[model samples]
Target: MHVLRKAILAAACTAGLAAATTPALAQTTLRAVMHSDLKILDPIWTTAYIVRNHGYMIYDTLLAQDEKGVVQPQMVEKYETAPDNKSYTFTLRDGLLWHDGQPVTSEDCIASIKRWAIKDSLGQKMMTFVDSIAAVDAKTFTIKLKEPTGLVLLGLSKPSSNVPFMMPKRVAETDPNKQIKDFTGSGPFVFARDEWKPGDKTVYVKFDKYKPRPEPPSGLAGGKVAKLDRVEWRAISDAQQALNALSKGEIDFVEQPSHDLLGTLKKDPNVDIVASPMLKAQYVFRPNTLHKPFDNPKIRQALWYAFNQEDFLMATVGDENYIQPCKALFICDTPLATTKGMDALLTSNAKKAQELLKDAGYDGTPVVLMHSTDLKALTNLAPVAKSLMEKAGFKVDMQSMDWQTLVARRAKKDPPDAGGWNAFLTAWVTADVMNPVSTAYVNAACDKASFGWPCDAQLEKLRDDFARETDPAKQKAIAEAVQLRVIEYTPEIPLGEYVQPAAMRKNVKGFVIAPVPVFWNMEITK
Candidate 1:
């Protein structure tokens, strides 16, 4: 493993040297090392963060959340909600045009929202209350709901994965289950498809035709002024080499630096580490409930008691400064955060796990754990999980693959041995899982649920109740009930929480600090 890492770093260093030696372009271009290689371009098809980031570069949203988590208008010039909250009318801002130079219309937004609703958890919940979504005119649309609910604007303004990114009607009409070939959007940047090389680099050129909102940029809610002529997302998988490149002026930014290397980067006066509380995430362990032994909830419960939160946190994030031992399903320090029904399970008890396995009539089916070796933050998780599960008398078969491959493979519903997965580890930004409706993994909607396919009708009902109840006290009570049901079902385990900091050269300025990275309003200075 050490030798392979060394080889990767060596190659990256050579590439950095080449970049440094190349003649500088006349146009201002910002070269960045993103968290992962860009492979999948269709954000609606998968909940991958990289793809969502790509979506933000090329597509606009109807509304967006500010730094304070307040939803604000973006593409929508203005909107009005009826007193009953059963109807919402939205008018698109002027000068919105697709990459192909066609004016963005109400029909386009409606189609985009419908497509996103099919795949996003929050969108699905919001759709349940929606009666009709019709265009009033070229630039105006109205959504009529069967009942009053706050999920309409909230779903549209969701700040993270599976974001409702507006696209041309032609592109938006594509089936949500399939990837769209069209890359047309009306955002700040235009995707340079011809320049894209999946494993090496992805390119984007600023869309000169895009009109920035008049409001000052706040989180992802306001103006997205593209200050750079071009942006290049160069794939440098090695953390040390990426930082070395940044220090030497080969690259301007690194989306995620390895936790242990922060001190070294801090010593370099040229590099700046940007860490935000909104950037915190919760690592999760999801068991595929479609196949045994996970199909049996009791068997799933056995492993719950076997694993410890602190072990997972320490194994993945060695830096004590970045790690947090949290058991809250919703996320610690949030309004819905709670440790209800987690008292006995947060601490490891192999003996108790073994007893539960016996009570569940275990047939010794091996759990197929998928390990994403490409992502630095996720590579250690499967090994640690394997050790903990084996300690509890569970047979484990660990499979290794790149993060992109794992993202594609996790969607399969086949049996474990038939190219399907039994369990996998992934993390979500706090914004993605802050509440019952927004938490994709917590949705127990049977076939409609996120990967792992865990279904509990009662749990689904509780989530619906939480979404419907508006009273704060009543909502808290319902949220606790939902958390208790999640504990009882074990749909997904909340391993722990940690912060991921982004490092960049001091010359790269105006970077947004939202839950997800956005390249707008940023400029490169020589």
Candidate 2:
């Protein structure tokens, strides 16, 4: 594997890896396999990565995050903050037209912001300070704040789940809890609704009407030039098959190649394995606090001590260079990252866990672990978790399903026997979980909280303080406080961190290295 990686490294450094530039083709189409199937279409409804990717294809945001994580105008021509910092005014850019041939308006943006505010974690935080969101004119809108908020741009320009994606007012008026069927947006690509076949394939065509900014594309900001005429996101569940397709030039890219097969893929001269240093993800074990035995914090802590972060990290990502045993819930390499109460999770203490479980009156309740078989990155987690938990004297019931099934099923408040889950292992990009305000898993707002819904008033208050804190030193102190509380209240287990690299055909050029996989500014060379 090392030898193959070295060969790949040498080739990558050479210009030979660059595709031969050719004149643009009239009907260019780039076919690729995404990380998962596009089961859900509404980005605001779920935190699923596939839906977020789909949202980027069809919807444009008011502001976008650059590679440096700075907010820049996308749909907006420019924005101005009031002298008192109590109001924010924005004007929509010209040539912004919805897919349905209607002019984009501030009314549409106002409704979209309101609907998004209810769903997104950051948006919800922003809403607390917002007094009223009103349309000033056809293209102008203002958000008057009851009090000043520091995260206005950050919330609006967040590059992840529940992104402030603009839509027509009618479509944006849909309830935040309800999913919208309408898919009209004024983005660089048009969703080929007729061609979409859910688990089979999803198609997108470049919007010729899209007028990109004059400056070059930068992350999710700047100009979004859709060089390809069409983009097809095929659902290839088998990583080897998808890699084989990429090797044979049948597919232009593969979003995630099987970790075990990386060595063989590295040997192929036709493929280029690309990874951004900024692209870091942490594996997590989320316990449903609404049900037993996870509802008991002692029972939850038993599983925490029983499992080892290194064991899970090794099993998920075999390469040690790509994986790290991260104990910090805020993520490593970030300011707030600290191993405050991680000593319990550093080593697997099955004996200690068993003792705790017995003291907590363990009745051998079956822990319904949701096993996502289709997603290669998450498939091994259930088996690993089951083995560890059973060793700790806990009963395990592993449920098998695709990632999409898990996404929908996790939302259920039913008991284990009634198609509900006790806990499920998933991963989040480090950028998404680095801060208290950004991480959805750490939210402990009870019924109003994220999926796990582990409500703790103290923890929520600490997070709220972190959001309002302008001083970096104060924010770090608040973050540490939050982490200590997170350790005490095991809302979710932070397994570890690893980097997943995407593979693409040599002909697929100009791929953007953003936190989210974007197809814009990329072209296929003949």
Candidate 3:
């Protein structure tokens, strides 16, 4: 993500493909069911993954990314960052209208930032790092930062990142905290309605009056327009029930079914299989600094020797060991991903692991391994890991929990203070973006007073340094330092990186598996 904004270059295509006999799906309603809902409704207030469903519908980021994860401009026509990097100037395009027919302006965003930065009325804590927001003119605005935040650009570009999303200042500011309901946006879709329920279902209707993004980098073909008139997302308990609906053509699609269904769907001509690599799987480990045994770097290093991630990926997905060890925090694709410490993190020497525990005087000591994952893409790897860790003379205890519970434990300071969790295994969704940005979301101590772990002042500084850094080499070095700091101190362990797969029915036209799924960009063609 760039410090600037999205340039809505109408995406162009070569020509048309063969046509099918299917009905025109745009006007037809599309029903989709997911395993769960993204929890928060207002993206600015919470970093909860589920909130994105709402964000994808009403809010529009200044920049939009392409399939290759390249940052492209959106609502913004152009912009520039100050030489010092503390301030960013953005120029908005004229005549963009919100759903209520109000002119979208810089003033709207300026005011919205003020609310999201410190007083996101819902009490959601995602924007605690924002410094300030100010407008220079009707068409221009500036975002001031606590530090030149490196992830600001990418954060802004995410489907629903923690940063401030623009809203019409007029209506929202009127009662500020009273109603807290404003459905106005300048994006491709407008808010139609929602029947909200926690852990239930929600429906969103499209704004027919929505303006089509201009030509040539045709936004729709490139996935910027909301092709369907409406989308109904349900929370169904049974995969068969959802897939049954899909096969009977009762629903358009369903997400995250058991592996057994993959074959069943492929054989059924009515339903097309949508298989997507979930995204980059990050290897997170607790550094030796957080607890006793892990506090010893030797024991920490011994972990790499204990894990057989490749074996795990093979069992989970043969030949699709697409989930491989990251080698380091900064992957090859991300700009300035810390490439150091990966080799140490991915080691699998059972004898050496035992020697490390012995040298550190922690041999045979039991350590807790908390997992938020439901199924190991590589189940076999667990036994291999257990054997290696046992060979190394360490007692491993494992437990599993739902994602929300896991988030509460990791982000909130509750039990597990007495090293209740010696260490944990999980993956990060870097999505081919820089590690620093996503890494923070996964492990950074947002508010030290509240988080269970002691804050690393060095990481805080690195976060600051990476933000303002302009020189690529300097930024890379800083990023590497951050990765090394995390690796050496291990609060969370990193095991492997994964690629999110975007599988759709063969008839699902313009389907893409972006880091965040965008409804406006999809179409069903036959």
Most lDDT-accurate candidate: 1
lDDT of 2 by residue, 266-382 (tens): 999988999776678999999999898999998988877898988888888888878988888888888889888676664789999999999999899889999999998988988
TM-score of 2: 0.94
lDDT per residue (tens digit) for residues 213-236 in model 3: 463232212435677666667666
Put down candidate 1 lDDT per residue, 244-285, tens digits, no spaces: 899999999999999988989999988889999988999999
Clashing pairs in 2: none
Q: Of the candidates numbered 1 and 3, which has the greater TM-score value?
A: 1
Off by over 4 Å in 2: 1-26
Arrange candidates by TM-score, descending.
1, 2, 3
TM-score of candidate 1 versus the correct structure, residues matched by position: 0.95
Residue 513 lDDT in candidate 1: 87
Q: What does the lDDT read for residue 419 in candidate 3?
A: 35
lDDT of each: 0.89, 0.84, 0.54
